[model samples]
Target: MQQTTVAKTVTYTGIGLHSGKSVTITLHPAPINSGIIFARTDLPGIPQVAAVAGNVTNAMRATTLESGVAKVFTVEHLLAAFYAMGIDNCLIEINSVEPPVADGSSLPFVRLLEEAGSVEQEALRNIIDVKEAQTIRVNDSFITIVPYDGFRITFTSINPHPMLGVQFGDYEINTETFVKEIASARTIGFMHEVKLLQDQGLALGGSLENVVVYDDETVLTPLRFSDELVRHKILDVVGDLALVGRIKGHVIAVKSSHAINTALAKKIIESCSK
Candidate 1:
């Protein structure tokens, strides 16, 4: 299959989840084979950074890519939107270190990309298909990629909170489901964790508007889906795998986080290359 990118630039502005500062990001048409690269516009000379598992040096609360003195944080949702939409190459230029946490969902980015108009390229795309059950375990959490004919993801969580109990979402990646099911699922957080995250200088851009904040028993807004939390988890997984370069095979994750996801991605790429 051929690669794709939008014809024109799309712009968006929102607050950074960590920096607590407003940020403006623009998606520009990149030459074929460029892949998804991030450019730090605020720095002198505007250095560029590649979006890949090898570039992901930090996977704390969110996935972070760093090279030399430059870094970008919280890239999963944006990456997932592009991956599920089948965008193969593009330039993500940002005025800040992180993209805007727009409504804490990929919906805004999805809309922006559609408005910009996507175009097919001449080069054939590359996908890393699983030849066997490739698995990686970290402590009690584990992620595995198994052989499948097309792209699919299944995610399960063990959060005890009422808003986040055991839940699951399964889908064969396609344009219709990507926009309706995955893109609208908002990233969620706990009300209590907010104070600690703030103390650590994280989630500074988080608010009830962007993310679904919950107390012990109450969700901040109406639930988008009964299993919205799980759906969002799948959303995150899709985004993280986008760093793998192109759409691949089935990925199954159980009780996994950003750290474990990136770790599994590294292992998969390494194992497949050999």
Candidate 2:
């Protein structure tokens, strides 16, 4: 595959899930080998932060990138969209700490990329193929990567709630299949933890409309897939690993969180060659 970038520029606006404020982000086609770069349009000098594991500064509920004093938070969903779409180079312009929640799924960003279109560059694509098996463990959760011909992700989500129980999904990562199978899976949260999160000043823009909520009885919103939670987990993993540049691996995870996902991604970055 040749290096790729968007054919046109596109922009969108939405509320930041953490800030509870509106923000705008624009995507522009970039030159070959530019990788994914984030520019803070709202900041002086328009500080730039390269989207990579080395720059990953936070993995709270989302992936955040920081360079110097510049910070871009909650970038995983957009990164996931870029990864699944086979985008090799692009510049992301952000007006705030995070992008719009946009129903708390990657679907909106996928739509943006689809509308922008993709163009193949003259340069050949640089990929980091997994050459060995590796695993990272965090408490009871773990994520593993093994050599594979194409991108594959298997996710198992474990929730104590009876409504969630144990659900899992295995996906072959591709733009078409991703859109139909995983793109629309929204982020989920439990009702009981809302107060705690609010106390921590998190999930400020979250609501039933943006996040799927699970009360003790059941899920508040209708599920797009029976295993949507696991699918979303896979989506998160794909997004976090986008920082690894490019890869061919079969990733298996058990109850992985954003932190563990990023950790696995850092390992992939260390293991693979540019």
Model 2 weakest 10-residue run by lDDT:
265-274
lDDT of 2: 0.90
> Which residue ranges in model 1 land beyond 4 Å of their true spot?
none
Per-residue lDDT over 58-127 for candidate 1, one digit per residue giving the tens place of the 0 to 100 score = 8888999998767899999899888877788889899998999998888888888888888999888887
Give the clashing residue pairs of candidate 1, or none. Answer: 80-239
lDDT (10s digit) by residue, model 2, range 1-274: 7999999999999998877889999999999899999999899899999999999888989898999878988888889999999898999999898888999899999999999999999999888889899899988999999999999998889988888889989889998889999999989998998999889888999998889899998988888888888888988998999989788989999999889989988888777644
In model 2, the runs with Cα more than 4 Å from the true position are none
Give residue 137's lDDT in candidate 1 (0 to 100).
83
lDDT (C-alpha, whole model) for all candidates = 0.86, 0.90
lDDT of 1 at 101: 92
**What is the alpha-carbon lDDT of model 1 when measured against the actual structure?**
0.86
